[model samples]
Target: MSKPAKRKVILGMMAASLALTIGLNPQQADAAVDINASASILVDADSGKILFADNIDDQLPIASMTKMMSEYLILEAIDQGKISWDDEVSISDPVRTLSLQTELSNVPLRQDYSYTVKNLYQSMAIYSANASTIALAEHVAGSEADFVQMMNDKAGELGLESYNFVNSSGLNNSDLAGSHPEGTDANAENELSAKSVAQLAFHLINDYPEVLDTASIPELEFQAGEDETIQMQNWNWMIPGVNAGHEYEGADGLKTGFTSAAGNSFTGTALRDDMRLITVVMGAETRDDRFDETEKLLDYGFDNFHEAELLPEGYKPDGEDVIPVTGGKEKEVSISTSSALRSVIKNDEEELYVPEVSLASELLNEDGEFVAPLEEGQEVGQVQLTYEGEEDVEYLYDNQSSSTPLVADQAVEKASWFTMSMRGIGSFFSGIWTSVSDTVTGWF
Candidate 1:
């Protein structure tokens, strides 16, 4: 056979061996999901799995979805001791002015009224109150303008690419005092892609889960038990059983938004059967359409996708390959994965998973064997577990796919020639003695 043909045969046999050893088989993979919204995405909040997405990267006016970041920064302030939930925040003029704007949502902040930071949080999170969000922004960062800078800075820190905040409230009013004033067109609005929104939501829920306690409130009187109280309602109607207009089961607290330029947008989260999903919908035609489309997005995720713990943190991979030492005390050292690997997988597609093992090709000498003077826990290689699909019949969510490091399982020191020669001489002498004893016993 030609050399190329012989190599092909060898490679085919190795692939077959890997499949049988890993219990993988040829099978269909996950199907793509289509959503009705202009831009949308559904992700596993814990694993950051993109179960479904439609134009998720197209930056559009995300309306009140911008509040997710506002809320995140406010919550972060509370966590870092820069502010306290119990601390009273004096309402600022910009916030008071926002209260008078009938076109925007407001919790009716009064400049003279002293409200607890907690009250402001509830109003902003549950009601999507523009005034309360700005009030909290001003109180936390000295001015609303400065607060917008913090929001943008935080977005950069989170590695978000498609977000620009002209205002903390997600309002698209050119009249507002900000650098990126609301434009006559969509570009002027606070913009982000559905994918970026999902990531922001992911950071929000993961870093400060306590914010959910505020977001999930169906209804609360702002400053309840105070002498003067304002009725506040969660604008997110998809709050499970809380909002009668659309009570999605497993739904929880999030924010909603709509503007003449941005249309309707929502960032929602839900949990069912130990799995939490984050959904983002932008530019839905109507108020109800946002909730309806989000419901469909969430349903598609919970139905089609399933979470599977592929490998626990600190899990060692099976059949860890040994690294041969060139000149070491030990001839070889074993290697394994240094971290855990988990994912949200498609149901019934477990058989199609291909765990591709690889080592740093440079670690191999011309003999195609690992040359080692290796230390324990040294990083040597990597193993990536993926599903087969159109990109090879893949079923695994891209974000949640496992890429684990292969580390040295044991230390291998360089072997010395003197030690090798001594061992060989000892073995030869021992064999000679054994043979001499056997012959003497036979003669006797």
Candidate 2:
């Protein structure tokens, strides 16, 4: 894929950051974006850190963005050999009914026609077609209801606590016209927090990057030269110079959603300089506001924050420092961190931070010495990174503020009683000999 147009924009921003280094301090350089969204969040796709958030946990209707889960399941089925891209999907009566509804966004299917999985995926990802999403759901799980259950199950597995999936496509329960699936309530609508949606976007992009292959197409032939041939264009306007008037440089796409119940919402991802950020905007005032707020959120992240490796992998803080064991075959046990520690910090303040390693209290007695029958790979403490000169460490720390575990590098087995007694006797005699030698020296 060609590089996003925002490469130049990001370079310029970096240059500006350098110039600001001469004029503004870190505190002055930090400026927050005020968005009109009812709920919004920006996340580092690589580190899963939240850079900016406003009412991020407030659950709201996500509209067609719910189709992201449907697309995920479809791609999974193909990967598992349960289905193939070329496999044909027969439209059901409900799917045909959805196709005819002028109120809903749909690909307009016919009962006599059969569409391939690839075709349906493209329609759902690019055009946000309601009928195509439901069709794919039914084909994959035998019913839209079962497919929705799968979506909910996946959400739970992902640790998503603030989401409820009522339908494969995000049509409101009322919009479904009492077509709500068997296990769901008649008035149910897919609901999730902006942060939860960002988490979903993170999983979607990382797990099924193949979704972008369909999402990036500005326009395509849905049926190619057939009587019902339809031209589809991506609704996401952030793609630089796409049909959407505002050209957001790195906006590749994820999904866009809107409905009467759920205001304009979007889950968008953009990449610049190998750094990808995901933004979720829910209940924006207008269609354009969703993209505009997303742009602000992305700019705030790219301009103010960065990801850095605080410590290298397999980092040993106290090299050759061993912890003493009370009863062990060995006198001491070795310790080290299992992996590198990564942190996100202000782009301009990366140099003023210091990392601290703290040993476990349980390993120490009153004199603060390690006492152990230590087990290998046992977690004994934590390594934390904090700013050196900053007055407000809390403001700078986030998910990246997390600690790496300090673990035992080697085990120390319990010692035998005879061995312990021999050492005790040797120490007593050595002390008596030292006292005699001191007295003889005094007489001389």
- Tens digits of per-residue lDDT for model 2, 271-353: 88778888999999899999888888888888877777777767776553466667567877767778888766667676686
Q: Estimate, for each residue in 73-127, the C-alpha lDDT of model 1 and write its tens digit.
A: 9888888999998999887666677676746777677766678988888888887
Question: Cα RMSD to native, each candidate?
Answer: 10.4, 9.5
Candidate 2 wrong stretches, greater than 4 Å: 1-32, 224-226, 318-322, 325-340, 351-353, 358-382, 386-444
Q: What is the TM-score of each candidate against the true structure?
A: 0.77, 0.77
Lowest lDDT sum, 10 consecutive residues, model 1, at 24-33
Give per-residue lDDT, candidate 2, residue 266.
Answer: 93
Local accuracy by lDDT, each model: 0.76, 0.80
Residue 56 C-alpha lDDT in model 2: 76
